[model samples]
Target: MFLKRITIQNFRGIQEMELNLAQPSGNRKQTLIIGENGTGKTNLLRAVALVMGGSDALAELLNTPDDWISFGAPFCQLSATLLTQAGEERSIQLTINRGDTLKGIVLANQDQLAEIDAALAHATQNYFVVGYGSLRRLNRSTGFSRGGETIFRQARATNVATLFNQEALLNPLNTWAMEVDYRTNGKGLDIIRQSLNDFLPAVKFHSIDKEKGHLIFLYGSTQVPLHLLSDGYQNMIGWLGDLLYRISSAFNDYQSPLKAHGLLLIDEIDLHLHPKWQRKVLDYIRHKLPNLQLIATTHSPLLAQQAQEHELYALKRTSRGKIALEAFRGTPDRLLLHQLLLSPIFDLETDESLAVEELKKQYESLKRRKDPPQGKLHYLATQIEQLPQNQRSNMNYGNDQLDLLREIKSELKARRDS
Candidate 1:
């Protein structure tokens, strides 16, 4: 259920990139891949999805074999080592030839392959739910073209989107109360309904039928269709639902003991989320899904800052057309970086002494030049001199002026640190 490591070769823009997952510790199970846009973040996710289920979900995101190879290179390869819940280890390696033919190889003992096959079969069922933008696009198109029937059909066809769609399909609270009765012991259907209601207060699903026609989702209270929630929301719900479904399936099998290891890969986890929400969302995932192994990519410095050192992979492109992934070290204070980046334009803090000395020098030089503009300079000097001791000692000016000073200070600090 968990991915121990992944080695990607000639996959899309990545000539070769290997990443290792840290073991789950305490209540947190998470790994964060940090990189700028177009630096193979999404490609990494595509590689995982492709290996996990061999689905077409990553088709649009991947380059064709011809395109994936370096300017004059050949073929593409992706491989990963995974540990399943049954304490069995497995490996998958996929290679694409120049003709676009894929050669897939799985390495494991018979029992491990059986487990991996089963898990992969289940994974394929819900793979479509992995991308939120795709759902939103489907919803918008369905709204105009098919009256939402297409959306519902597509969602159900890909089991991944069904939970969100199902959540949306439930009646409003008041309506459900009128139609459904609570059981005496609050078990059975009542428990299911209550749990659904509690876990999904903001979610609603609407369907309309024309006489004998099939039901279809028409509208939702949330801005997008249930399928079209923000990527963070979609990823959270989809991942949780997938885990729950797998757990339920495992329980039903009876023969397999409950396995604690699970692997999760997320790309651009900060997509369509604000900084504050990003932290909260990630924290929620880590806390709520403690036993699962998580590997995710992000461009948000905030996310990088929040992640543990062992859980971070910094991806950089080498001149030879290969992606080099290195474990991130040192304390990355994203907020401080943000402040320093903004300081050049706005002064978050000021040195009044330096300001006064500079002003005095300028004023004296202006007076020595016998400039008639001494009137304005004199007025500025008098204003500076009249400032209170505390204010004059160290002043924090407005953003516009403070920014320039901050940049200067940052450059000096960088030099000193180096």
Candidate 2:
């Protein structure tokens, strides 16, 4: 199942918020929420967790409405409606008091308290939500009960029975290690292994390593371990692992037909990775996992430019510390956005007239300089001379400079022709 819509009021830094996911007739997928840091992006996710199930961390981090809004505000509210794979609709509603005192110190009120509790309950019942900091907690508590009984006992028993039938469980501990090894070594996950290999031919995960170590990516014979690798690579690995694990868990849950509906929310998706990788990675995710819904936040213009206008959510902070989110206006095509974001590096411009003027200035400045033995100017002069007269006239160069340029150009031409 996928979330169809989310509505929030007075949650954290957001005074009021409403977001809807695109539900095409055939494909009802997860919605993407795009915003820069502190634009209530993570708060949006927290609202989901709160409405689905009250997470204590969310409660602690997100101040009640009174703290966010002007003094004397009453309550904060959040609601979401999700469409399951079976075509079932599920709705969650939450309300928390913004102002109250714990003993004598100011704190969130009873309604807020109830909402937090209710949200946590809803999350546990429905969506398989995973946050960055909570993976270890989930891994530990997922299949075990407080009383020590395995929660998914039947499923585990069935798998164990199958293993025994195949003589795969003769040494239980060793078999478990071997199974993990196989998965990590890229043996069983055909799609994931192929995808990773296609893009990152040099990277490998070593499951047998006690620390669940992963090999440093080797691009053209360079090998760097996790500790030694750039932060971007490390971030990519973490995201990749989370994606694989979530998909695997969904597939294993036989009773849930809603397994096909997947939503991944990433905060600061552009962190650590270079601009080239930032653009490449998003394109890769969209093409490789068409079935999965992906939403991410990034400050990189490169990342923003790659996103569709409808997929973007720009965030601005107010003086009162509240955040407002809206779609970016006048953004050209996706590719243009990417270019505009990287304009500082590439000198790309959206305004053709302005770009022409800028190019003219650059050409004139380059013409006045003493010709360097080797550099961009020499390269430019060579390229310009090769152009036809009609094309040369269309360039931003002034008539006089173009004339002088042609004299120098002829000297070079004479040298070449000789």
Candidate 3:
């Protein structure tokens, strides 16, 4: 199931927002939601996760519709359009009433008693949506007693469960590997390893230590357990392994598990990943799983630069205490990294320190003048020299801020007008 469109009203900090997740020419692509912290990126994803993943069980489990509902509003509604594999489109709405204190689901576009049952059945599982919050820490629970299908609305009460449930921590890949070790071709464990091994050569996850109960990877010549890997690797691979496991289970007997269609929501996709990896990680996912509709949030400009046309979105908090959604136009990948940061995607006016910014304005002012401003060049040079070494290169000037300022100083000093 591909979540083709969504419109949220009075959900959390967001008052109203609408989005279209379709790409050009009917091709499939991922959507990157970018916003500053506390700008409702998580809220939007959670709203979708709650309604799509089944809110019936989740709403009551969470028991906090008051929090999900917007302030001063008696109710909140999440409207969505799901595109099924057969090309059928379904519209559904999940509403929470504050006065009555109950959750309700009904057909959004139809009026019929007969369609209610089918719609209810279709709401929960027919159109699948699985997600991970910003803190996607996978537990090393190998006991096989961890909560499963029964937990996180049967587990999307409006996404409160998915994001706030204490039991959200997922089981490690080792436990699943141990369960399916060598039986039935390790039961999709190889799907994760084989699919990602070449793509992630830095972490050579060649095999698993079946008897020792640990997923092993060759770090050069040393065999390192998943726990022994750096936090960067652990944070990334841990949730990814769990995600692949979920996809494989959901799409069993399909043409290709990775190619299966569904909505994959990831909050803060750049969490624990280095900037270098952040730049290409989304692209890698898009290339490998083109069919899976990816909805993820991130604050990294490096990650934002990977967004193609019509894929980058932003959540900005308004002055009236509501969040607004903005779709970024044009190809973000064509912009330079700094340009991307300054663009609406990041909403950054300047990638410079206040000191350098003030200096730059003055420099431009003086450079624009045709004639004398005696000893002005010396003063600018002194100010540039006073800046800290670390802040020098980040002045948003060429290679070195010091070098650029010195060039201006030298050029101005040699001027006959001076």
Candidate 4:
């Protein structure tokens, strides 16, 4: 099952917003949402979770009774268009009546009724969404819960763990040990190992140090404990391991291969990740779980640059203050960081650094004075040349600075020739 599109209204920071997220004609399974804070990126993810995870999940996500509605708005609505595993269209919608209970409906084509019903019965397994937030804890004790800190994680962890081992619901450490150990079934470990290697070529999964009760990831024969790794390493392991565990739980056999497909929603997906890793994470995810659909939010332009144009979305605020979606309008691969920073996603008016900004202002201020001393002109040209090329190329005045500098240098040489 995959979410083809989603519509959200009267939900925190979103008055009315609808996004058509169906993957374009391609084998790609990734979609990205880029927005500044408070643009409702997380809220958009929650709307999908509410539909798939049901009312209980929504209740836990909302705080106040009125939190479901936009400030001063009477009601809230969440809806989505879905594609069932059988290639049939379906929909799940929920409406919150202010100060009252929430109402919802799940609809399917008459021919797809039975199939959709069965899909709903195993909704968590069919559309498993791992909504990872930005602030993941590092150096977590080996006994950390599989679900992490969110209410959604806690509940899903319990539900899935119940299906595999009732005892694991109480002792999550058992789940952790099984996840790191290849001896259980050694079925999907190679796939996961390959994924990690693809993202971090030098790092390899060595083995579980059974006596020490820690998972060992190796760097060229050097043992690295999960807890002792850098924040970036631990964060990556934390989410990836949890996802593998959930996928494993779907089959009720740790050694058995994953037989389910689902969605993954990560906020600030680049958190604590180095730029190099940021560029590879999305591709690694696609390679590892080709069937899984991912909708993630990121501040890293490096991640955005790798996405296809159609797969990238920017959450924009209308003049009225409601949120809207805009498809990125540039060639993703050709777009550099400076270009991306100035895109609506980043909303930067000037991609120039402070030093460049100061230099440009000085140059402009000098130019407005009508050809300051030749020494000054030469000095400004030298300073501009010394600035980073990326910053220089993104100057606000476009090629005007270059032309002015060239003209000044020519004039200085002409005086000497005369």
Best candidate per lDDT, number?
3
Assess the local accuracy of residue 50 in candidate 1 as a C-alpha lDDT between 0 and 100.
Answer: 53
What are the lDDT scores of the predictions, listed in order? 0.47, 0.48, 0.67, 0.64
In order of TM-score, best first, we have: 3, 4, 2, 1
**Model 2 over residues 1-418: C-alpha lDDT tens digits?**
5667778887665787787665345443323344545577766765665454333333333333345442445776777776766877666565556444322112333353453345335643235443331111112121111110132122222111211122211111112222334555644433334435544434643222334333334555655544455455545554454444434443543222223345555556666677777777666767666655665666666676666546666556767867766654444243554344433322234323564445545655776778844466556666555544453322443466457556757767776798
Off by over 4 Å in 2: 23-38, 54-72, 99-125, 133-179, 182-192, 198-228, 246-260, 317-322, 328-334, 338-418
RMSD to the true structure for each prediction, in A, is: 11.0, 11.6, 5.4, 5.6
* Residue 224 lDDT (model 3): 88
Worst 10 residues of 4 by lDDT: 103-112
lDDT of 1 by residue, 1-418 (tens): 5666777887767877787663445222577777655677766765665555433322323324356554445767767776655656777666555556222222222232343455546753322113211122222222112222333333222322221232212112222221122222222234223223323324433432223222222234433344445555444443333333333333332122123345555556665566666665566556544555666777676676676546667677667846777765544443354442223222224444677757645655564675448466546556544555332222334555445344434544565598
lDDT of 3 at 284: 77
Ranking by lDDT: 3, 4, 2, 1
TM-score of each: 0.53, 0.55, 0.81, 0.80
Error of 4 at 39 (Å): 1.7
lDDT of 4 at 378: 61
Clashing pairs in 4: none
